[model samples]
Target: MNVLKDVATGVGLVLATPVHMLGRLVSNVWWPLKGVKDEIVLITGGGSGIGKGMALKFADLGATVVIWDVNKKGADAVVAEIREKHGQDRAHAYAIDITDREKVYALAKQVKREVGAVTILVNNAGIVTGKPFLEADDSKMVKTMEVNTIAHFWTTKAFLPDMLEKNHGHIVTVASSAGKVGVASLADYCASKFGAVGFDESIRFELRKMGKTGVHTTCVCPFFIDTGMFEGAKTKVPWLLPILKPELVVDRTIRAIRMNQATVAIPRFLYFGQFLQGILPPSISDAIVDLFGANDSMDDFIGRTKKD
Candidate 1:
């Protein structure tokens, strides 16, 4: 009887899948956010890498983009490039330390006044320190937490009230694949990203409970990209766990935001990683991780500074 019941449930889900997809398609067609002229989108850490890529894409799509970063020169350079490609008025750059709550709030208000209503918020700022657990200092750990995890709270709190009132907005949190699986030598980085993932989930739940389904939330977790941050990180299975390009990640991320996807794991194999951990024996899993040199590969880590 149990077997038959399970089969019936599976069949029901299969039959309902098309209807669910069709509903989403129709809803999106009626209320498309992509290429919506004059829509304001704000991206943190928009100075370089994935953030800069997304900003360029959005501006090309006719959105007014605000590039917020602590690196004023980098931010201005990106804005200059955007202005050359898309009209001068389409992109703006601001220097901001997202970790400061009051500063973030002030920036949000300034953006609203100077640009327009912010329809999209992308929290893409992060820093990674590759020290071993024993060598990790409190100051380094605190900075990581401030930038990667707590900044999300500050940004969300500052912008969400406006979203709730307007009833239209999207929030994208750029976390790391490290958040899903704990590896050696990156304890602090992993912990900070894990907190970001959790924070995204909790906010999603709160939105659902409040009946604000239109306020879309997406959490992105990707493996080592060819970004400056992971300059020396080696991939055990290049084909399976290939280091992604920043442009590719940015493209997919923008598409996800436009479509209002709730979460995304790049490389696709990451879902299998999650499944494996749930079923694999502890010793077996540990052996696999060790074989990949997943932890100690960062022993000679040289990040963005080295790239310079």
Candidate 2:
């Protein structure tokens, strides 16, 4: 009986060898490595805050980066710094408004021609006007949607064909944690972000269905960030949901993009908030939200306009 048991174990090991080998082959083929050195990466709104942070990180990692921002001077400055640090050919800057579909398509073509095919696209351009729903003008609401939500579609449509052709690429959508929840004085902002989150998730699902698994999508949902974008905004839970630093956020986001993870939430606790919203009683959840001052915190919001 002991001899029979030993033989059975040996047979099991023999069968498992092929499975182990297959797993190793997949990892070797797909895992992040130095091969990304020559790949081109495009980051929208790359002149400041989270977008700039991501651009710098990618450039540091040896990928050729393009800074696409509406702020021509700011983008040029970032490009200068990158070129200074990484050599002149490592970085480039383009001043383009992503909301303009024609301009976005033109820029994508120009990037492909000049910088090589864009292997990574970061949709990070967004705007937030902290006006109550009733107080928001039609123009303000339209501009908010155009910049925050529609730009994603325009930019993605412009560059995704190249990714599909290559069958390898990453799309990173820098959405806010507010995308997952509704708050006061930010109805427009919340709607736009939520739309972005949905867009990223849907694209991911479609890619999986199409068997284009090599093309990865990551939706980053982080709480208030210390990017000076939300300068005077109050924090509901400073300890639990401390405003994330741009560097830290960019680091985690890069990790997620490298790993091809589906979604990334900063603080990790925000996942619990999502779960609680679904399970708790409406009144109890409402009371908790109110107690946390989630709605009222944006009342004093002083955005990047106040910054130099």
Candidate 3:
């Protein structure tokens, strides 16, 4: 009976796959986007880079925006810009270290009191130590894990309860292509991102199982962006794998949030590459990676000096 059930499930999936794909394609292209005008969006690392860009975009869309960063000045500048274009009450800035779980919880409560229950949470702040594993500083590695992976837990916990109560919210995880595939010279960074990607997926499944289908989760996995955070990073074949731009990533991310996309791989080619990497033998996969010169792309690393 169990074997029959397995065969039945397989047959059902085979029949459903094409229809699912076509429905997804059509919905992505033609579905009316969900509105965010009534939302209160909180974005970590909103001081600069993609975080700043997303803040401005969300404010432009008429959502109240909150910016959190260790760099208070940068967060304030972004808030000021949003106010100038939108309205005085359209944006707010808060400076806090997301790595501190207790502080994060405290600030979250303050945000709720000052602004409102956060309806959209964007976990975007991350740091990278572009050094070989043996050469990487122990402190920097711990910092990287705290910011990239562990902070997600703190931030999500701080905001997710409200989402569960209402069953109407969005969580955007700004991970990296490094989260999906390993690259040379980024051992610490890659491990942190892998954790982040896993975190997002697990939470998504948990939410669905709890029947909170309206609470959407999007895990954004983009290749290195031109955001100075990954300065000097390069690809041997630009046509096949060009470095992404912050603007492009921001736009796609917003769209994905509206459409409630589960996982968004920028350039779309990443999906194919990941599929191949999964099915191919280790030796062949390593050879392909070596041929593309991906592992050596960080040989001349000059990442941003300041955190976002």
Candidate 1 displacement at residue 49 in angstroms = 0.8
lDDT of 1 at 276: 87
Q: What are the TM-scores, per candidate, against the unseen true structure?
A: 0.88, 0.87, 0.97
Q: Which segments of candidate 2 are over 4 A away from where they belong?
A: 1-35
Which is the leading candidate under TM-score?
3
TM-score for candidate 2: 0.87
Candidate 1, 100-119: lDDT as tens digits:
99999998999888888788
Candidate 3, pairs of clashing residues: none
Model 1 residue 12 CA deviation in Å: 6.9
* Model 2 Cα lDDT, one tens digit per residue, 187-290: 99999999999999999989999999778899999988888778778877888878788888998888778777778889777877888999999899888889
Question: Among all windows of ten consecutive residues in candidate 1, which has the lowest summed lDDT?
Answer: 27-36
Cα TM-score of candidate 1: 0.88
lDDT ranking, high to low = 3, 1, 2
Per-candidate alpha-carbon RMSD to the true structure? 4.1, 7.7, 1.4
Cα lDDT tens digits, model 3, 186-295, are 99999999999999999999998999988999999999899999898899988888899899999999999988889999878888899889999999998998998989
Candidate 1's displacement at residue 123, Å, is 0.4
